[model samples]
Target: MNKKTIITILIALVAMAGQAQKHLPAFQYSKEPAVLSGQIIGNNQQITESVHVRYSLKYTSGMGDALRQTSAAVDADGRFTLSLPTGTTVDCHVAVGECRFICYVVPGQTVTFTLDLNKLETQGLANALTFSGQLSDFNHDLVYATEQGIDPETIYRDIEAKRNMGQLANELPEKSEQGYFHYLDSTYQRVNELIDNDREIGQAYREFAKAVNRYEWGAMMPFCGQSIQYAGIDTDEAYDAFEARLKQRLEVYMKDDPWANPVLCYVMWSMPETFVDSYVSHPVKLPTDYQQCHLASKFLEQMGAQRFLLTEVQKDSVLTFLPELAQDVLDYNERMERELSFVSEQGMSRVCTLPDNADDILATILKPYNGKPVLLDLWETTCGPCRLAFKDMHDKKKDLADRIHFVNIASENSDLATWQRLIPNYIGDHYRLTKQQLQSLHSQLPCNTSGVPIWVLINADGTIHHAFTGWRNVDDMMKEINQVLQ
Candidate 1:
């Protein structure tokens, strides 16, 4: 062969190899940890305020469990590293300061990225971020797809809106089933078109994106035409008939094997408890995938929490159904039980004696910390979001322990024993109030008492500084707390 011809053939061969290598390999579950390291290019003040890169994992157990967070501190130079323990490819929201974006983390791989804080602040688009290393293609594709409006959250919200208000409304039992099915098919086709148009995304990512869309629709399918009020199923007979129809639809849906992919957990994360319970009780045959087994075990784990303990029978059933995950299930149960037992035994120390008078409870609770800014957390043990919030704030609370007086208050609605048991896990001044005392405090405070996880900021001078409900990130809370401190 001529020299030029040989050189051309070699170059063509190399190009073909590069093209083949660009396609991502199929996902394999692993116990090994994944490393995510990155640098934030921004001013020192913005970097300093960005304390931690926080990401949470939701696996088989669902949202009933306390959110499992893996965080790494950002140094003075705006560099951060996180070692995430994931068994499969999972979606995570990597948040630093006010900037947050969805990224996929794969087991046993390192994905490095750079966050341009200036661009994130100015444009508020994560597409400006750059990524490299293993699994970088997946992350890049995810961000690009999200930016282009192919986001799972957006699609889910659109579906929900149509289900609630449009012709696809679950409440409209008389709506044509074929029409609804057509809508789902069209939505999937649109998503596929977006994926097809994106020539940059790999084959594995394309499949993952489509799987997410299918599973999300499957998750919501069981509720179609099953709204109790809309169906007018007031009697037991009618209720039974309605349930049977729903089960039939669900079984048909499950035939597609929606749970085969471990990554579907992302779509299922925000699903309501009722939906999960219905899924677990459905008579459809289970998938043989180990991820499916693990998810089933996690669902059982949540069910076990209803009584605050997993019974021996329940554990045995888990072992029987999920033999592949037998040891894992047992170890998780034992570890959780041990942690609960330890915390329950180590009851919290009261910072001050309760006032004999029940009136003005808020004033009485703040009397001990008159000159220190107090961040009052109102929560209950049975509340999942409340406990999750506490877990999220654990490290942040410790960092501010000396600077702020953290007080936690619970009412009679929460079990006294349970309250004592969990309070030790959160290091703060604890108080259990009577129903009447709680009502009195609510009347005095400006915050909304409609929820359990309420946060009230008490100024150093013993006056209300701020009050809000629900969970807030550490940086946002710090901003308000700093104002009160200054």
Candidate 2:
């Protein structure tokens, strides 16, 4: 090869190597391109504060746990900055204790969040699974899946669409025996017919229970491990068989794939709380010792990255295994944290907030954005009211954007094009986040927007200046913003 070509190839190789490094180390900012500089602040110093946070994918996929050992600390001035994975729809939390907070992450934007302390939670799964709308989706999806016998995605989207049509939660379809799944409608009819007929999915358990009776231990293990929600109609015979089979499943899973599906096992165990109580506490219990609990916690700690499905009790039970796990969970708490400070609420500076790393840009945001009365307008493409509100607000942007930070957040579905077309100027320095990200953001605010076209205004001190929902709330919203800014 010519010298010139050889030199050119070497340069190209170096550039490729540089690009390759970007995806490694997961949350490495350059290695993983991300929105920068998240901040959490506390209003009253005398009142210790705590904030919670989680990251997520917009759709029903999985999420990454974002408590960075290096970036986990809250700041002295009551701010914490954190970096999220590239392409992550991140959620942040703010709370004092068991009470809930509001969410405020930008849709699809790499994030920098600021929250106050009055809006944090410190107990239970309700405190941990900080994603707000996710449960609504879960409940809606479960009921729809049972009724329609369809995949969770289709059911989830159906619920969203119904919401757009302004349907109430009660108005949605319920678990119907005669729907497409149970009766006849789709290719899955035959498969649906084979599952347990009992409403509680106990019928499926009965077959497995009978298998246990016949000493089909191998087959019974799977029955115990399978999703219990799908199980219908529990019986005494079924419960006993489930216990027998599940004991075997737990043994096998704990031995081999303990971390493989921690949430599923926990959920499975929780299915028949009554039966599991009897089974586990049976004369032949799971050693009736804390060591086993330690083992279970180890599995959970190792699998914390994909812990969206884990309940608080499950997470706590596992963390109780080792002191370090408890420390880490405690560490996740950001106290009176500067939304952009170095030390976390736990009083450790080991973890850094988003601003800690990208100080320059963060400083820029805080310079003028701080303490300035700001109005955050949240809307998505799929939301008709959100679109209408966007258009309505768009008419006033010339007067608003320069005075207050008016951000139009695109929901994850906005990328689908169909959702995008409804809104004008699908351009600009817009912040996009998934519903999960939005929910995570909600973990910080005093109030959250259950429906779109919501307005959240905050003062430079991070006090929630005013919060409201609805297009009609716009006038009141404007007044609040003006008062806060003035």
Candidate 3:
């Protein structure tokens, strides 16, 4: 053979060898969709898991529908099969990391994942994303998590769980923030689904959302307060009709549904008049028609919800009569203060409860650190900034050791033994509190201690001089501390 022919044969051999070495299957789903099979391995039978696979479309990018499939018990040997979407690429991942599996399917396909129960529990609280994606961008993340298909509703609901739990509240209006609106819109849409049977309810929610989004909290608050008054004046108005519709719908939806958060859409629907009526610049005295204006509040109160929150989200609602409410808030503080005093008597405790209120949380925390400025560092086992901040604080202690009191606080959820081991001979006051105790304490001492690496200048005067909100703002903290010292 000629040299050229020999070279051609060599090229063929190289190409064939590359094909053989490919780790993924060569089949294309767009043409020949088939079942992907897998088995879950575990050390024992009790370790078995039900795997859920979320599939996404490849070419459409992440916008394509994401579908999910589940498998029966892997044979005692851990085996199962899942059918893939035909004529398209799909990717699948387990929900909540419920169980791990190695997917064997067409290569070059897009995929996404759903949170398994554990993951769902971990993130669904306070409205967080249950799953993370390997992709870089939001779209890619969505695609990677559910390349086959996904229930936008489920994703939104999971987000709602996080939001209600306060985990997703800080994510502003952006793509990473899509989960917020996604859940909001999805919630409104679901309520609308129920509204199909009850237009009155639909109209009310739509109006609530409209007012909330366009108008400030002031307008909606009083309007609802007045709605209650008007409700009493005219018991037969559409407002009453809508209220009935809303409650009926809620009875059906609240079960297995997280509704602590109202969708921006539904919130808009609740108060349309906000757009038409200007907010009161100053505290507007209730018109002589005050009783009339607040008929809705009375009605709702009668209905057993005005006290709940839907109607009283802002001060303007009942604050037309401020002295009373202010007194209540103050009294609540007094009660909390007493609690904090009790806590102060019992220093170095564990934080265990998620708070019922944001107010007075600081005083509660301060009880133990009373008279001594505490370097309250809320570090978790996995917090990175906290570790850095703790070390930095420790290093600085030599200078302000006498003036500032430092306490390394962790959640009560942490294993005390494990924490002791991690810190080893930890001399500083170590404290823990439930979600509740931490929150209540923080609210009173909102020096900006929103997240961990929190540094506070609690003076001997029983007044907080400054609070640093997040570890990211550590420099701000340094400045504040300097100001306090000066």
In candidate 3 the C-alpha lDDT for residue 461 amounts to 59
lDDT of 2 by residue, 30-135 (tens): 2243333434444555333434444442211111222321234455665554454423222333343443332323323343433333443333232222222222
Candidate 2 lDDT trough over 10 residues, lowest sum: 21-30
TM-score, candidate 2, is: 0.26
| Alpha carbon deviation, residue 339, candidate 1 (Å) | 6.0
| Candidate 1 RMSD to the correct structure | 7.4
Instruction: Say which candidate scores most in lDDT.
Output: 1
TM-score of each: 0.61, 0.26, 0.27
What is candidate 3's CA lDDT for residue 252? 37
Candidate 1 vs candidate 2: which has greater lDDT? 1
lDDT of each: 0.67, 0.39, 0.42
Q: Which lDDT value does model 1 have at 218?
A: 67
lDDT (Cα, tens digit) per residue for candidate 3, span 1-486: 999999999999987754432222222333344455544433453435554666543211111112235554445655555556533323345432343322223433432323233333454321223222221122222332232223232344454465456555455343232333344455455543442443222232233332332222222222222222232334557556644544443333323222223223212212223322332222223222222223333323222211122225433544454332233333333443453344345442332332455356666555655666566566664555665454344335545666766666777556666565545222256666676666665666566655665666666656867666566434656676666565
Better of 1 and 3 by TM-score: 1
TM-score (C-alpha, index-matched) for candidate 3: 0.27
Off by more than 4 A, model 2: 1-368, 416-428, 434-437
List runs of model 3 lying over 4 Å from the truth.
Answer: 1-372, 425-427, 447-450, 473-476
